[model samples]
Target: MSPSQEIELTLTPAQAATGVVIPVTLPSGPQRLRIPPARNGDLVRARVGDTEVLLRIHVSGPPAPAPAGKSGALGCLVALAVAAVVVGLVIANSDDDSTPTASSSPTAASTYTPYTPPTYSPPTYTPPTYDPAPAPPPTTEAAPSPFDTGTCLNGQLPDSTTAQTVRGVKEVSCSADDAHYRVIQRFPGTHDMSRCDANPRTEYGFSYQYTLNGSVINEYVYCLVGIGSYSRA
Candidate 1:
């Protein structure tokens, strides 16, 4: 039998959240209870908000009976299902591990052989031909005169008194038809007058050689080429 009188206790903040179950004598047998509002232990689970605060009981009682063969058989069936799942997991992991390792090794390279080109010998060289140049024309210098002579016995060539009586002479001659000859003289005379016969003792003069075209013989037979004092060679 149980007494009807009841007692109540308040909970501290730490004790309330920790689920510290307190068993008190209820004027009957020992009963478990929580602190806040002093609620029944079974009615108020040892939890505060979302947290479950585990609180074990150390009560004196008889041991419960063992499970029957039917319960054991059900447990064995569950254990076999779990074993099958574990084997499947092992096989899946093995496949993943083996496949990646096989593909990781590199493949072999292809073989190659080089081609050879044929050898060539060069042809002999041939040089071009050319003609020789023609020879140059010959060169020659004719000889100078050996005997050329003259003298002014009458002083200078152009005399003031005997200017009208002056005589011309051909002192030289050329052998070739294209060749010709002329004469020149020097004397002590001014530009306006020549002392051709100033004095027979003081007469001093000179003469030079020149040319007249032999091919134009008729046009220049008696032409006076140049005037000078006189000369003996």
Candidate 2:
């Protein structure tokens, strides 16, 4: 701002952390700004007073050492003098010891780095906040469909997998959507299927034999009436 321009006082208290909400006044009205916390000696921008101007504020860095008054300086000098006299007396009264080793040493050149204070940028856009823990990740697992273990529920067939042994048939998919075994007929191994075969004949099928192909333990053969084979045509 020009020398004549001045900032109005703010109602917000000083802050030393980020995301502090500062209350400021503008010619338009009073407003709250969420400005990031700044270190001492940093310049922060905020609308102040009854003008359109935004004022640059200097943050106080470290605390300044208290100025030594005249009396304090004199006391410091007297302390230094007393310390020197005591040291001299101690040396005069000390017993002789090994001579100290001396080595030539190089003095390091003093370097000064220019100070660069942090500058505050406008805060980024922040949406409304929600505090609740994120909704528990979806409860379901990538599990085998219920149909994988049994026959179709109602009439909804299970999405096919590589191979599922159901009844006496190891139903296998033949297409993208999958081909399934809808048992058109069932019979005991001891009984003949000659009079119970599907009209078109099942393309592929097997028995539930446990020990051998067609063993008596799983004597039931799940027969398919029709393969349901069809193309886009």
Candidate 3:
């Protein structure tokens, strides 16, 4: 590194292999050095006349795809395949040995007990003699449906004039013009009366029908309250 300390190096081709050899000589003096070799981006390690100095080396071309020891995985796979083949061969041989061997000569007929069917007798059927009787005429009219008039007392809105007749927790009223009839009541709101029955009030051309009992009525009341409280009036 100083001005007086000078070193020179030269590279020559080796005759045995396609590799280069570098020879370096230090200045004539009593000296000790741990110096490294000259770095030229080549695939050979630089050495001082075949003497390694810091082992500076460069390798060209792509690295080997797999390392040497990694072949054990492939070897193990091959070994397993071979082992499977060996085991399969062993099993096949065992099966071949275990099976009942066939003989060239025909075997004697089996002396099995013969199966006998039981004798069954058919029964004789006798036909009965018929006596002609006068036939009665069939009833034409269908009997009235017992629950045909099963109308809910609170089912309909009464006419205005007939409003005074029926009174309960429920109220029924109609306009004088008969244009609007409302059956407003706190009836049992257990079911969705609008579509509850096959023949609902809506189906019969009634204005409105609803149940007014239990949780359903409570829900309706709560909804009405909520609407009234939050409505933009």
The prediction achieving the highest lDDT against the true structure is 2
Which residue pairs collide in model 1, if any? Answer: 150-231, 155-196, 156-196, 181-211, 181-212, 182-210, 182-211, 185-228
Residue range 1-233, candidate 1, lDDT tens digits: 12223234344434433333455444334434332211112122122223222222221233233246658678567545533221100011211222211111112111112336689999899998888888765434343332222321222254223333334422333332322223223232132223323433323222323334322111111112233323222
- Please identify which of the two predictions, 1 or 2, would achieve the higher TM-score against the true structure: 2
Q: Candidate 3, residues 34-132: lDDT per residue as tens digits?
A: 112112222121122223222223334442243366686895574355332201000011212223221122221111122477999999999998898
Q: Is candidate 1 or 3 superior in TM-score? A: 1
How does residue 149 of candidate 1 score in lDDT? 27
Winning candidate number (TM-score): 2
Ranking by lDDT: 2, 1, 3
Give the number of colliding residue pairs in candidate 3. 3
Error of 1 at 196 (Å): 22
Report, for every candidate in turn, its global Cα lDDT versus the true structure: 0.30, 0.36, 0.26
Q: How high a TM-score does candidate 1 get? A: 0.17
lDDT value for candidate 2? Answer: 0.36
lDDT of 3: 0.26
Clashing pairs in 3: 189-211, 189-212, 189-213
